[model samples]
Target: MKTNGKKTGSGRIAYRKRDRVAYLYLLPWLIGLVMLQFFPFFSSLYYSFTDYKVTGGMNWIGLDNYIRLFTKDADFHNSLKVTVLYTLYTVPLKLTMALAIAMFLNRDIKGINLIRTLYYIPSLFGGSVAIAVLWKLMFLDNGVINAMLTALHLPNIQFWGDHRYALKTICSLEIWQFGSSMVMFLAALKNVPKELYEAADIDGSGKIAKFIHVTLPQISPIIFFTLIMQTIQALQNFTSAFVITNGGPLKSTYVLGMMLYKEGFAYFNMGYASSISWVIFAMIVVVTLLLFRSSSAWVFYEDEEK
Candidate 1:
C-alpha cells in the first residue's frame, strides 16, 4: 500500500508538470489575444463614449457624439442611405451571378479547371488598390472604355464625375468579384446527391422544377451563409468607394467606411469615428441576428429531415 501511494503521488506530479508545459505553450497566444485583439476591441467601445482625440487625451462626453449623428448629421444620413443602396444592389446581384456561373461550371468539360481558375482570378485580386485604380482608369472619360465607345460611335461617359453612374460603377466593381461566392456555390452544387435529381426526373419534373425543388433546397444552407457574408461585406464597403470615386463627385458613393475614415483620420474626430465604428459593429450584429432568425425558414438541413 505504501509503494502504491508513492506511485500515485509521483503520477499526479508528472501530470501537473505536463499541464504546466501545455499552458506555457498557450501563453503567447493568450497574451496576443488579450493585448492585441481584446484590448483594442474593448478600448474602442470605451472610447466611443468619450471625446477621445489622437493627441488631446480622452474627455468624457456621454452621448453627445451619437446625438449629433442622429439629429444633425446630414452626411451621416446620406452615407447611411448610400450604403443601403449599395448593399441592395450588390448582394443579390453578386449572389445570383455567382450561383448562375457556378451552375454553368458544374459540368464535365475540357479546360473546365482553367476556366474556373480564370474566373477565380478576379476574386484573388479584386479588393486590391491596384484593381480599384484599374477600375477608375477604365471608366475615365478618355479611358479604354470610352475609346471602345468611340469605335462604336457612342458618346463618352463621365463615369466618375456623374452622380448617376458613380455609385453604379462602384457596385459593378464589387459584383465583378463574385468568384469566391461562385466557388462556394459550386462546392455546394457538387455535394448535392445525383439521386435527388433522378427522383425529380422520375416525377416528370422539368429542369426549372428540379432546380426550384431539388437544387435550391439542397443548396439553401450555402445560400444562407453566402447571403450573411455578402451582406456584411456590402455594409462595410470601402475600397471601391474610396479608391475609385473618393466618395465621389457629390458624395454619391460615400459609404459608412469612407465616412469613418474621413472622421477618424482626415478630420481627427477620433471619438466620433469610434462611435461610427461601434455603430457599424452594431449594424453587423443586428443584421447577423436577423439573418439567423430568418435562416430557419429557408435554410435546409438534410439531418433535420432525417
Candidate 2:
C-alpha cells in the first residue's frame, strides 16, 4: 500500500509537471490574446458607448452614437446601401466565375498546373493598395482598357469617373480576384468520388445534368463556405473604393469599411466610428447566422450521410 501510494504521488507530480510545460508553451499566445485581441475587443465596445475623442477625454453618452448613426447620418444609410449592393453583385459574380473556371481547370490536361498557378496569382495581390492603384490607372481615360477600346475603333468608357459605372468597376475588380475561390472549388471538385460521375455517365446524363445532380450536391458545403466568406469580404471592401474612386463619383462606391475609415481617421470621430464598427460587426454576424440557417437546405456533409 505504501509503494502504491508513492507511485500514485509520482504520477500526479508527473502530470502536474507536464501541464506546467504545456502552459509555458501557451503563455505567449495567452499574453497576445489578452493584450492585442481581448483588450481591443472590449475597449472598442466601451468606446462605442462614450464620446471618446482621439486627442483627449471621453464622456459616457449611452447609445447616442448608434442612435445618431441611424437617424441623423445620411452617409451611414448610403454606405449601408452601397455595401449591400456591392455584396449582392460581387459575391455571386465572383463565385460563379470561380466555379466555372474551377470546373474547366479540373480536367486533366497539359500545362494544367501552370494554368492553375497563373489563375491563382491574382488573389495573392487582390487586396493590396498597389493592385487597387494599378486598377484605377488601368481604368483611367487613356489607360490600357480604354486604349484597347480605342484601338478597336470602339468608344472608350469612363470606368471610375462615371457614377453609374463606378460601383460596377469595383465589382469587376473583386471578381477578377476569383482565384482563391477557384482553387477552393477545384479542391472540392477533386474530392468528389469519380464513381458518382461514372454512374451519371451510365445513366446517359448530359454534362449540365451531371453537374447539377452529382457535382453540385457533393460540393455544396464548399460553395456555402465560399459564399459566406465572399459576402463578408465584399461587405468589408475598402481598398478599391478608396484608391479607385475615393468613395465615389457621387458616393456610389462608399462601402461600410470606407465609411468607417473616414469616420475614425479622416474625421477623427472615434466614438462614432466605434459604433459604426460594432454595427458592421453585428451585420456580419447576422448575415452569417442567416446563411448558416439556410445552409441546412443545401449544404451536404459526408458525416451527415453516415
Candidate 3:
C-alpha cells in the first residue's frame, strides 16, 4: 500500500508537468485573445460611455451620447430606419432567390458541377471593392446598362443619382450574391430523405404538395440558420453603400455601417462611434434573440421527430 501511494503521487506530479507544458503551448493564443479580441471588445463598451475623440482624450459623458442618438440626432434616426429597410429588402429576397436557384440546381444532370461553379463565382467577388466599382460604372448615366437601354429606345435611368432607385440598386447588388446561400440550400436539400418524397407520392401528393409538406419541413433548420446569418450580414453591409453610392442622393443609402464609418473615421467622433457600434451590437443581439425565440415554432429537427 505504501509503494502504491508513492506511485500515484509520482503519476500526479507527471500529469502536472504535462499540463504546464500544454499551458505553455497555449500562451500565444491566450495573449492574442486578451490583447486583440477581449481587450478591444470591453474597451469599446467602456469608451461608448465617454466623450472620446480620436485626437482629443476621453471624457466621461454618462448616457448623453445614447440620449442624443435617440432624441436629437435626426441623421442617426434616418440611418437606423434606412438600415432596417435595407435588411428587410435584402434578406428575404436574397434567400428566396438562393433557394430557387438551389432547387433548380439540385439535379442529377450532366455538367451540373461546372454549372454550380459558374453560378458560385459571383458570390466569391460580390462584396469586393472592384465589383462595387464595376457595379457603379455599369449603372452610371452613360454606362453599359444605359447603352443597352438606349439601344432599346428607352430613356436612361439614374440608378445612383435618383434617391428612389439608389437604395434598390444597392439591394440588387446584395441579391446578386445569392450563390453562397444557394450552395448552403443545395446541401440542405440534398440531405433531405428521398423516402419522404416517395411517401408523399404514395399519398397522391403532387410536386407542390411534396415540396410544402416534405421538403420545407426537412430543410427548415437550414432556412432558419440562413435567415439569421443573412440578416446579420445585411445589417453590417458597408462596402457596397460606400464604394457604389457613398450613401448619396439625399442620404438614401445611408446605412448603419456607413454611419458608423463616418462617425468613427471621417468625423473623428470615437466615443460617438463606439456608442453606435454598441447600438448596432445591441440590435443584432435583439434580432438574433427574437429569431431564436420564434425558431421553436418553425425550425424542424430530425432528432426532435425521433
Candidate 4:
C-alpha cells in the first residue's frame, strides 16, 4: 500500500510537470500580450490625464480635459451624440443583415464556393482608402444614385448636400460592409447541432420557427460577439465620414473619430485629441459593459453556470 501511494504521488507530479511544460510553450504569447496590449492600454489611461500636445511636452492637467468637455465643449457633446447614434444604427442593422444573408448562403447550393468569394470581396475592400474615395464619388450630388432617381422620374437626390439624409448614406456604406460579420455567423451556424434543428423540423416547425427555436440559441454567442465588435467599429468610424462628407454640410456627420483626427493631426492639438480619444474609449467601455450586463438575460451557453 505504501508503494502504491508513492506511485500515485509520482504520477500526480508528472502531470503537473507536463502542465508546466505546456504553459512554457505559451510564455511568448503571454509576454507579447502584456507588453504590446496591456502596456499600451494603461499608457493610454495616463495619456488621457495629461495635456499632451504634438508640438509641446505633455503637461499635467488634472481634470481639465473632462471639465472642458462637459462644460465648455459643444462639439465634443455633438460628436459623442453622433457616434452613439451611428453605433446603435450600424451595429444592429449590419449584424442582422449579415446573419440573414449568411443563413441563406449556409445551404449547400450550386457554386457556393464562388458565392462565398463574392460575398467576402466587400469586407476586403471595406476599409481601404481607395474604396472610401470611390464611395465619395458614388455619393456625390450628381452621382449614380441620383442618376437612377432621375430616370425613375424622381427628383435628383442629394446624398451629401442634405444634412439630415447625409448621415444615412454613410450608414448605408457601413451596412454594406457586413461581409466579415456574415462569415463569422456562417461558421457558427454550421457548427450548430444538426440534431436540434432536425428535432424542431420533426415537430412540424417552419423555417422561422426552426431558426428561432434552434439556430439562434446555438449561435447566440457569435451574434453577441459580432454585435460588440460592429458597435465598436461604428463608434470609432473615421474613414467613411472623412472620405464621404469630410464631416460636412455643417459638421453634421462629425463623429468622435473625425473630431479626434481634426484636433490632433490637422490642428496639431494632441492634448485635446487625446482627451477626445479618452472620452471615446470611456464611452465604448461603458456601452460594451452595458451589453455584457444585458447579456446575462439573453446570452446563453451549453453550460448554464458558465
Candidate 4: misplaced stretches above 4 Å? 1-39
lDDT of 3 at 192: 91
Which residue pairs in candidate 2 have backbone atoms (N, alpha carbon, C) closer than 3 angstroms, thus clashing?
none
Better of 3 and 4 by TM-score: 3
TM-scores of the candidates are: 0.90, 0.91, 0.91, 0.86
Q: What does the lDDT read for residue 258 in candidate 3?
A: 98
Q: Comparing 1 and 4 by TM-score, which wins?
A: 1
Model 1: per-residue Cα lDDT over 6-114, one tens digit each: 3366787976666678778999999999999999999898888898888788988999889989899999999989998999999999999999999999988899878
lDDT of 3 by residue, 205-255 (tens): 998998888888889999999999898888899999999989988999999
RMSD after Cα superposition, model 3: 4.8
Residue 144 miss distance in model 2 (angstroms): 2.6
Clashing pairs in 4: none
Q: Tell me the whole-model lDDT of each prediction, alpha carbons only.
A: 0.91, 0.91, 0.91, 0.84
Worst 10 residues of 3 by lDDT: 1-10
Model 3 scores a C-alpha lDDT of 0.91
Error of 4 at 34 (Å): 5.8
